[model samples]
Target: MTDTKYRKKLLMALLAAVLMAAMLCGCAGDSGDGETSASSLDGEADAGNRDNAEETDQNMELAGSEIGREFTERDRDSSYTESEAVQIELEGNSISADGRGVSVSGNTVTISEEGTYVVSGHLNDGQILVDASDSAKIQIVLKNAEIYCGTSAAIYIREADKVFLTLAEGSRNVLGGGAEYTDTDENTVDGAIFSKADLTLNGAGSLEINAEYKHGIVSKDDLVITGGSITVNAVSQCLSGKDSVKIADGVFVLNSEGKGIKAENTDDSTLGNIYIAGGKFTIRTEDDSLHASGSIVIDGGDLIVESGDDACHADADVVINEGTVLVNSCYEGLEGYRVVINGGTVDITASDDAINAAAPKNASDTGNQDRTSRQEGEMQPGGEALQNSDMPDEKESLDGEPQNGELSQNGKLLQAEELPGRELPQAGGMPEGELSEDGEMPAAGGRRGGQMPGGGDTGRGSIENDSNAYIKITGGELTVTAGGDGLDSNGSLFLSGGTVCINGTASQGDSVLDYNGIAEVTGGVLMASGSSGMAQGFSSSSSQCSILRVLDESQEAGSTVTLSDSAGKTFLSWSPAVQYSCVVLTSPELKLGETYTLSAGSENLEITLDSIAVSNKTGGMIQNMP
Candidate 1:
């Protein structure tokens, strides 16, 4: 062997030994579960992550678990074995019981113990009363029962841990209550089926409730309906739950003179909510169809509402995760402090603002029977205003409201810092596109302040400071035909991914898109048309391109507004039900530094997408650039 060969083999062996040592050191640095060693510098960060995980678990428990729970197999069981049940037979104006816990009176039947009672009978004028121990759980299975109470609740639960009213399969039941409640003890019983404890209604049967005086089904605690086909006709609320109202799956046809469904607990922040996981609802009401003082969560459902007031209202938040909501007619379609639509199909036709994000004056009042109107001579919540007044003769605030005076042209009050040297008769005061003696109103998009068209401080901070009033549409298809502002947000409006088409008011005092803070469309298709006097374009913070054009003349109703590229291929088109003098269009397909053609009726214009937000006065109305 040569000396050079021996030296090469020795060097190779040394290199292999060094690599093996490095691999062992790397393994030692890990804590065997892919985490770093606790003694390392990253120990504090790992501890914080563990703490966050525990906090998230705690928050999830408090989120909606207190409001309601999904039905377990035990809750839906309507069949009780002979050994575990008590038998009660109801004869006309009399009753017979073969159970130890039940007793018969002249015309009423009372159950005094905790057990399952199968009731099948016809009661002409009597009541089924449950006066059990406070810690007892009771179940009353109604099978082909017809009950009526002339002066009290048909089925009243005075005390219990929880009561399950199970409608037997394939059976039909009817309960009718009188105009006055006579069973008044420690609790007021004003419903056909009134319970002081938590109540659960489940089964595959059907029940019809006719309430002559007050609510149809009243529960002082949580009220949950997992199944069954129920129809309710009431003078006041069809379903009133003091703590919460939760429906997992059911078919409901409710008609009421007051409200369709409501939750009226305001003492606790976690109570007074409504959660609908899956159901079918047809509600016609004189007031709001669904009202909650805390919050509302709609995971999946089909809701059709014809309401004299709002279709859905919540004092805290209204979230639609997935559902089909059709508001055929309403005053305000959806009103809440924060309205969020993650995914759904929503169609709204409203006389007032279609989707509003405004705080109610009294958050505790879920009924909202005394909402103030924004009319001439009426004052705002926190201040006094002149009757039929114009712009105040004082310095204007940064939010366009007068600082030292009481009148704002749009009838809203603001508590904002003063911004001097601004002229009177500010923008957004009159109806959009309304003309002055000079043939044009002031520039609507150049307002110095943010408040316009019911924008106020609202006790919530400005939009930049975590304001509670906002409209967020992450994904959905929203079509709004509104007589007032199509989408009005007092704080801000956010559109990330969705399709929004608004046909706004043709007259004065409203616009297609009105926001006090900012309207940002990062990824969405928005086609809005309305009056031009109070017109507004998207904010410059948006990533997409938009076109805001004021037409030369009013476009008649049913005139198609189209946006086409230079090749004349249309990309977007919509026909407004009402006349419009202004149009706003934006989409992801619209590219910056591109030119497009816009057509409305016989009018055509060559529009170049020059910037993120473009405002043009094509009809020689007024030229303002932002």
Candidate 2:
């Protein structure tokens, strides 16, 4: 039989194994033809089955207290720059902002003016409130200060153009907030340190914030943290900035219930950006560890994260320039409409896909153009396999033959497909603009459609549906352990250089590396192991690679696999965490006409690069690259 025919059979067999596994797990059952029932796709269970309950319980107990494998410390000398010092000595129950327009009432000190204020001393059940001129620039220097607020923010900036919270060199300080808060006039605060204006946190000292209620620190505008030794423990979110969050340099340990850090501004698409130039972040959270609405750009940082949901998520785009990221646990490791990895060392463990490039189904399809292009009917003749026994989820749909440009599952414009159920009259006008190279509608396209995840009302969502979504790996070292799919993209996938390793033998609905559109490997080392059902190979390749299928008894998890040339030169080696029936390998040294022997534990096979497949044959459901 031809390699293509053999591969097709293997794919079918792998699907059979996956269906059995799912049934055994009591999560799902196979459709008659060995595919997941379409009815169960909408509300598919995402809960991962832990290998051991005792280990999981123990891990949950130490989730917040212990982070990443290595404990990190900060460089003290780089904390602050030399500046002017203004003293505001704290005495007993009384406090002062000194001659800078301030008044002390009992344990609380309110600043009605703006200026540089250096504070020292301890206060019980008190706070510092800054209510100044709208255009004023305020600065507070904390020097050996300890503050505890019973029912309000420890430091509240009710009104200010911008505020700078600085830590004095060599000093240690603590700020604590009560479990509940009392509203101040018409204002409502939700953080231990709350600010309604632009805020900058910088200094050399070690500072800690304890939030028993909402968040550790929150800024309504931009929040920038440059330097300090900061620790935060919050019942809700650790840090939040409504407009933007920028972290340059700091050492942060965050423990939170809701999220570790959030930058959400649905009111303005250009506002909710997250930029990290340099920092050390050790985070544990019940929700997403890092989330943003606009975009997340990490230039440099060290992130050790544990999250209940996605570890890193961005509605628009996620760009990793240089960083060391270790996601210990998560539902999904990394998610974005556009995921671009330029350079980084990333390791992830997840219950779902480790690296996903997905977007809302029709994020880019707006206007009647999406409605008019489809065939008017229920499901087509050959779509019996796509029918569902159960009612579909409440998806946003137009009642008609789609006229507005309809985006396909592969990020392309649909040609002639039927509606799932019913069809009728056409409504709406023409689509606004053309799709950009990045899968985004041009600026002229504007907003028109419905909501697209990330809790945003803006019609602009995943670029994947807009023809701009994809995974581009120019450089990086990414290792993933997934309970579901490994590296998956809704659109095209391009890898020019990098090393990618997948631990999961995706026996589910996807593959070790799944793509809706084309997948190309021009140069790089790609190693994959998975069930043969969806062990997809690249569409085209210029690099040396190998594709192998083995008996189930021949491959086992933790068994070392090695490949060597005829001259006994080692080329590739790996040890997978889970057993797999298929293995794909690639490297720069495996030249054509050179005989190479591959060993998986005790079994061995010999083949030449010319005889092996460097590029994969296109089949299944994915579309070819245009």
Candidate 3:
């Protein structure tokens, strides 16, 4: 018998074994034609074998968006019969292929037909160029192939309906590019693997790519990776999908001087998005680890990122449904016009804001396009100083409260006349007093006017400039340690459920919870600690109880801060990683007209909750509260 027939029999034998195993499990049965019946698997289980828990408990349904579910049937298929496959072999600089649509000239091999092509052996300095008809679909199986091009991509797909590059099972493949591009074609090719058509990679093998000049892999259309072990090291972007990049399942290790993975199509908002359903990614880059011009959605993945700039940045919105995101180091952890974390485990250590929601800027106004060449600490192009319109009025207060109707500590409204000796900080001037020995400003007896150290205001209610921007954390365990603001929203902040712990900036200009609009927490456990100079707590409109306390002295890092009810049952506890003088906490368990004990290192205080939002920064406020 032929080798092809022998392999066909082996495949049938494996299918039979799988069908027998399914029958034994009572989940499926064979149809007597060497095939498992799909309907058999859908039958109701016997009472004795039924699971105690609902099936939904084991397999949680994906969100309504169902993002990145466009992979076609052919994109996920990697099987090929030996009889129908064209075999191409490369030995050093020599190549041999007798296929009808394959043309070889010197060391370059070109494919012009749609069929399964198995490529193997080593090419010293050659290219596998695919120039098929626009409607043709091609599949190239790399069976332990090694290819390198001196001045262009080793694998270039100029035209095709779609291409599937499958790494043959158990085989290892490598594609490398030189330091320069000598191609003068109309289409610029600048990656080890450049595809002008839609590209899909799926298989059970491994592929390593090295790009010395530009990107490791560039797809002009959509780029989809369903399976494979891919390692890419590039000078610019490790992976660049102009339209969209969707990864269903893969093992990726990417390192680049520029962006690790990015979608660059800015013309259409829906086209320039990234969606990762399942993957294991370790990315280190100088620019954003994952950037999209539109939106970025992480449904399921394990991403470990160390970036010189933002770890995950999107010009539109960024939504994390379910994933494990560990940003070991970054300039900003996650930034977008709208940032929403529904269900995930996110831990970020950043030099700037950990979670920031700012208005989207124009492409030219944003400096991230050429960030690799920009100098650190230098102002970006089109940067401008803060204008008076950007700051709130000096007389305004937080949460849109009128100047004369500011809510006092015990939920009683305080009139302007009630604060006789109160003084508002002047524009570009400090309060008329010297700093205390502990570097704290003396209490002004009542709430100070909304004013920053500079001419800008601390911002009251919704910021007029970026009113549409917001940050919403519905469900997640998010922990952040930052040198700047922890959770910053230029517009508003909404926390409905989850656990948020922030060890924020020690600098006086930043705060742990900074928002221009209302910061409302209906249900959640929040513990934030940072400098007291510009600290802002949850708005009085929140349903859950909250407290903002400014300590007389800064607490050292590693000091335990605990909050417990009158019965001494601890509900919230955290140890900050930086020295902090301000602490804010909110939880559903904290009720009105209840007493709680707050322990900060060596100091302890009993706080009586008289209102939904409590603050100790107002002097003589506790004495006046009935």
Show the colliding residue pairs in model 3.
461-517
Worst 10 residues of 1 by lDDT: 19-28
Q: Any idea what lDDT model 2 has?
A: 0.60
Q: Rank the candidates by lDDT, best first.
A: 3, 1, 2
* Candidate 2 local Cα displacement, residue 144, angstroms: 1.5
Show where candidate 2 strays beyond 4 Å. Answer: 1-86, 89-93, 360-466, 506-510, 541-554, 590-595, 608-626
Give the alpha carbon lDDT tens digit for every residue of 246-265 in model 2: 88889999998888988888
Tell me how many clashing residue pairs each candidate has.
6, 17, 1
What is candidate 3's local distance difference test score? Answer: 0.70
Residue-level lDDT for 116 in candidate 2: 74
Cα RMSD for candidates in order: 21.0, 15.7, 21.6
**124-199 per-residue lDDT for model 1 (tens digits):** 9989988989998888888889999988889988888999998888989999978988756877788999999999
Candidate 1: regions farther than 4 A off: 1-69, 363-466, 617-626
